[model samples]
Target: MYTRILVPVDHSDTSAAALAEAIRLANEQHAIVRLVHVIDLAQFAWSANEFLDVPQLQSSLRESGEKLLTERVQQVQEGGISVESELLEIWGGQIARTLVDDAVKWKAHLLVMGTHGYGGLTHMLLGSVAEGVMRHTHIPVLLVKATESK
Candidate 1:
């Protein structure tokens, strides 16, 4: 029933796992996959714009994101799935919020992403993005961890 699958990949191993799952689902359902990569500019997180040209840094980040998306899109296409991609730039560290917003804007039926599977202290400190998305949006989310259990 899910025809619009949104896959947010960060080029990590866990993200790769998520992409694989999304592709498999897409193949089964004859769905379209939208690949998204959000560029979080760390330099803007603190007071440090003097050394970094904002536009230049943004451009560099966008280019890197595009490259990442291009490779993943190719892989999905080769797997016999239709795909489209976009690179989102958010200056602050609210990446999870941006992702949720993008999902709505794209009219995505589902969000398939990777979770680091952090727990306890690490989870408290890092604060999971997948978790954030889940809390903020009612959209059905399929979180694929780095590894699977038997």
Candidate 2:
């Protein structure tokens, strides 16, 4: 049984679905769930125009990530699950690597995450973090694909 469950989430239906699954598993195993939200300030800030304020954009991203983590933590708590959360802000780093590192650092028994399940051209353009985690991590991972209605 998974005594420590790690769940990485974002502001997406896929992520929400993954959190739901994590909560269920945590309840079943009487485990503690650690929710993580990663914000890549470098990628997001550089994607904007030169006229945009980089510092301001980074701050906003951090705030947004914190809000998302707070909300998700509340949701998990409401489910009567033992939960904690972390908002990771990276300048320019691999998200999957960060997740894996966190999972290892936390001694998580299982890492649960969501996937959009994009294929072909879309997947090539938007690289899959879940796939990367699956390929790189030695820890067990649970991938929850977003449903159409979600």
Candidate 3:
């Protein structure tokens, strides 16, 4: 029933797993997939001192994000799914909010992404974006938890 699937990709194994799951779902539902790579420039903006070239850093982030999106789009296309992609840049904004806004704007039927599944200290230190998205939006989110490292 889900016709438009939105997947956030970061080129990590966890994200690849999520993409695989999204591809399988898309194949079964004959749905289209949209891959999104978010570049949070604000996170690095704080380090923009006299020694830091903020503009160059931002450009590099955009280039890497675009590359990731292109690679993911190709993977989805290889799965014989109709795929499109977007590289979203957010400055001094929440990544979860940016993702939810894009999904809502695209009218996506589902949102699939990977979660690192950190707990305790790690979770406290690096807040979970998936958790944030879940709390902020009504969209159906399929979070593929990362596999345990060997």
TM-score of each: 0.90, 0.94, 0.95
Q: Write the per-residue lDDT of candidate 2 for residues 9-124, one digit (tens) a residue.
A: 89899999999999999999999999999988887565655888888878888899999999999999998999999998777999999999999999999999999999999999
lDDT of each: 0.90, 0.92, 0.91
Q: Which stretches of candidate 2 lie above 4 Å from their native place?
A: 44-49
* Tens digit of per-residue lDDT, candidate 3, span 1-150: 999999989978889989999999999999999999898887777874678888888899999998888888988999999999999988888989989999999999999999988899999999999999999889899999777778
User: 1 or 2, which is superior by TM-score?
Assistant: 2
Please give the clash total of every predicted structure, in order.
Answer: 0, 0, 0
lDDT of 1: 0.90
